[model samples]
Target: MVLVWAAASLAPGAEARQSAFDTRASHAVIMDYETGAILFSKNGEEPMPPASMSKLMTALMAFEALEDGRLTLDAELPVSETAWRRGGAASGSSTMFLEVNSRATVEDLLQGIIVQSGNDACIVIAEALGGTEENFSAMMTERARELGLESATFANSTGWPDPEHRISAADLARLAQIIIRDYPQYYSFYAQPVFTYNGIRQFNRNPLIGVMQGADGLKTGRTSEAGFGLTASAVRDGQRRIVVFNGMETERARADEAERLMRAAFTEFELVNLVEAGGGAGQVEVFLGQAETVALRAVEGLSFGVHRRDRAGVRAEIVYDGPLRAPVQAGDSVGRLEVTTPDGRIFSVPVEAAEDVNRQGLLGRAGTGLVRLIRGG
Candidate 1:
């Protein structure tokens, strides 16, 4: 027989459901860093121009190189005519002002790319690592797939306009999570406020750095095709969230919307642990066993982001095939717990027997069998 029972109730202090969020951004996603749970999304999966925001991938490649001894921060890389001509001061785009054929250490190039959003720095790194920008971009596309950035594709190291170069807001947020979780040492470079090179200094393009509380590291991108976009992360009271948005009308709108979305991420949503690992899941009837019941426990904890107002609709159910035959061993798979949120998302966690339940002796089994026969057929 199969058995089911309610396992959870409304969270404390939950309020009435509120209206869904509205935003002017054409694409957006907000995620909880710790749980990898998406808090909100609108057109987040659609591929769109990433602009300089894709530099996060370029930076990621460099961080991995440093980790495995393929490259050193102090090692110098050369700037070629292509880098200086196409992406330097003459290009009327972001640059590190590198004189053609000059050299800069990997560390300086990183600061240039991150804090200055220097296109020249990106090209230099691309050439040094992959022998050419075309080859390097191919490498970027390959590595992006390996990193599980499903919507990411690379056509150039600088994220310059290209019909093929595209990434979605959702993938950008996932990439941000990967960097913050795997490369803490290199991730700090994103927080740098300014970079000065060759008698020129430029401020970081990220708009959230100082204006938003707990805002630390991230990148910003803008182009005629991509519009204003940002991929940013913030931490408050030990919780971190990553927000990616694009297609805003203006830089000011991007800034304002980023702050607004991030504020809501921390204030209006929560990571709720509905069921804890090793906790009692439910009780199961035991057949011809020493005990009448066997306790079940969750194999792992279940958690998800829920809107504050929707907490009242959160529900958990324990489901099991009952009357388990003995001898039941501790940790045997018994059933699962199913959770349904207000948004109709269902999450399930496997449950197992919490303790051993041995079979009863022959006499005890006979007596129980006789009682059952007398009560029924």
Candidate 2:
């Protein structure tokens, strides 16, 4: 039987609900990792200086180089005068405290960049990979475009104050997603609490790690122009959430708001199972076939996140082109099942034929056509 589901209409009593979180940051976004749902957003798309948080992109490039065998964890790269003069202790920015001519392994640099927010480490990687910091920033911008981050523009690898350096909270969240999805092996470095270098141990600057439950790797940012920012991720019950917030007044506020938003994203919403795989959601008429109708089922199980209070407004609809023709086979693509939440997010799953239906014989076709004509079909 072809299952034809009527488009669901919004219930009269259903009302749209707003997020309860009142964030202190100037820009913020909370997203569900599995469903691609935006739990909350405020100025999320507006471009602003990413500050040290831009190092995530720098780290992504290094991870890519490592994966491609262009670099290795134990391989040591020589520190350049430019890296020393511009981003080193003399530059008064975050540094790994490398001597002018000292060599450091790729692993140590990555740890320095991630744990200590070392600007010098970023510059060292930039010089090692692209031969110059300018070239590396340009490469970062090109890679951001390839990654579909339209709002991201890199002026420097360290996220130093530059009028042209900018990225949106949404883009930061997307960047975090790519890092987690693409570089799982290297991502553990982000969670490291401390890295001892040159006999000096510095704790990871990320606020969420260790303080928030299930929180793992990510980065933090701060500059006079960008204020304070954080790109954080956490996993709970097998579900991960990504959050990016910037332009907070202080470190404490950034930490508090980030943790609050992360908790709310996982707690306020629920994963609702809408349709089970291989189960018929509805049926549709079949023309000139052995069976008069055919059932339709989602090719896979369908589920989505819904706000607990707004669950009443959530609706699902099976959408297909038309009444199917004969010779239908099980698993044939038919249409899509769409689930819409009260907040206006739509999640779609493929619909398929539940069973086979052979074409009718000549006489059977004629009889069916005649019956259909009498019924004014």
Candidate 3:
């Protein structure tokens, strides 16, 4: 049976729903890094051209390759003629100014991609890994699926405008989570301020790095079809948030919206620890056990983000089949704890027996049964 414990007194305020946050971007999503809670969303699930912001995927693929020994930082990859002709200075697009037929180390290429947004560097890495850019892009799409990205599709490593190239704002934030959580060592490349290749210097295009406190790594994108877009993450007071947005008319607009959403993400919400790990969740009646009741505990701490204004109430339910029959061992999975926020978001965690509950002897069990019958139980 489910036992609900509504914690209305935790915070003193009337029940209220979170107010909607407005944004100028056509697509946007803000998510808490720790809880993966979506603080705000606007057409976040719809697939749209990501422009160069998709380079996050390219960076992720390379990071994985380095992890599994498929590629090394110092490994040299040849710059093909196609890479130079299509992505080089002659293409009038972002380029690393790579000299055709010259080989560059994986380390330098990554800097080129992350810091310079070099289409040429991305192509070289693609060819080195998949033997061709087209094949590598297919690998990127497949890897995105493997990573559980719901709406990510890739047509090129550089994120050059292609009708088939698409990703959702939600997916972009999720991808950022992966890069930040799973690949911490390489993530610093995104924060590098400047990179020089072939005697020419370029600065990282991400606008938030220096402007926002605790802002670090990320990518920015823009194209005729996909207006200025950004996938950024920032940490403040030990909390991190990821923000993704697209379809702004100008770079300044994208920068403004990104900073605004990030600030609001932190200021407008509060992360509350509802229950501590190993803390008592609730109690459950035990049947034919030496103990009349058994305590329940959460396997892990439970935390949720609630709107600051709506910290009004949080409802939790301790659900289990009871009275549970003994003998119960400590740490046995017995039930689950369901926590609901004022905004109607529910978070669940498994609960377990906090102590042993040995079965009562036959005579004791009989006596208990008689007593229950007398009490009309």
Candidate 4:
């Protein structure tokens, strides 16, 4: 039940399996946030309508606006006639009950968009920043590309029905990661339960929040063609997991499936503490340093999914070809620790130098080389 990943340069998760994403979802994926690992996927890379998950990127743009001094939680904005008319209704269409000619703060619009999924809020924010939805969409596309969302396109502020509009669950997960990672300040707003504006209170529609354990915040979307979807994230026992579910039959099904996957992840995996900053988990010889060698350890914890009975075979091997040369960066990778379980399940974590060792000049290198040669002889 642990999330699987398709490999990537810096991503983490399980390897790909064609049938892994064979849930009720038409397109779906569960991913590990830290490592960009694809845990599970089915048609995960296919470009399908994103419904309101497009709001994730919209939120990112708002966050960027806040950072650059163009927008703020307290800054007020006017809901345009066009935005109000187009969005702010149900039936899977824009509907926040926004009134034309009403003034709403950037924060107000955000809650309406994020919590209520108001189309008006999306357009209002788009116009407030990009001067029009068309321009804002361009910005969204640009930012998506910048954040490695290689499979996303924006046609409108809200993810309504459109043949040309589409996004992948993998891309949605990446979008969620970027917003949370790069815009921590603005992201706190996503967790609020109820947003009150214009004398009305609307509760958050995301089922994961308040119900699922550690489910704090994210966005959801739905359309006849797109189905129900969410880019959900949660942290259980210090490890964070993210999921993107698309084309679900019912709202609750997505929540139930996501919760089950999250539980599986928390229970199956273990986070092992490796080296601390300036602390060594193990030592490797240092050539030409004042000392014979220096120590290395886990940067944080080297936690992974190891079955209970297999813990006996969970042996660690510190790998390095030979003594490391001096002038090494503090966080430089000198080796890797491979952990193998009794069942032959294997995982590898990068091993980094606990501290920097300045390279000794030619004389120092020669001295170490001669010592090594003499020892060999």
What TM-score would you give candidate 2 relative to the actual structure? 0.73
Candidate 3 runs further than 4 Å off: 1-5, 9-20, 274-302, 310-377
Better of 2 and 4 by TM-score: 2
Order the candidates by TM-score, highest first.
1, 3, 2, 4
What is candidate 3's CA lDDT for residue 291? 93
Rate residue 117 of model 4 by lDDT.
86
In the range 1-377, model 2's lDDT, one tens digit per residue, is 22324433334334445533457888887778766556666787889999999999999999999999989999999988888888788899988887778899999999999998888899999999899999999999999999999999999999999999999998999899988988899999999999999888999988888998899979999999889989999999899999899988898888888788788878876666667787666666778889988888877777665557766675666677767899999988988887666555667888888899999999999998899899998
Model 4 reaches what TM-score against the true structure? Answer: 0.67
Model 2 scores worst on lDDT over the 10 consecutive residues at: 1-10
lDDT of 2 at 374: 100
Candidate number that wins on TM-score, 3 or 4: 3
For model 1, name the residue pairs that clash: none
Tens digits of per-residue lDDT, candidate 4, 1-377, equal 11122112212332222231136778776667786655555677888899998988887888888889988789988888888778865334656678889888887788888888888899999999889998988888888888788888898888877887788987898888877778777777777788877778788878878888788779988888888777788887677877788888787887777676556555644333333344445667776776666667655545443333333334556667667767676788877655443333345666688777787878877887898799992
lDDT tens readout by residue for model 1, 113-143: 9999999999999999999999999999999
Winner by TM-score: 1
lDDT of 3 by residue, 327-346 (tens): 99999998898876654567
Q: Could you give the C-alpha RMSD of every candidate to the true structure, in order shown? A: 4.8, 5.1, 4.9, 8.6
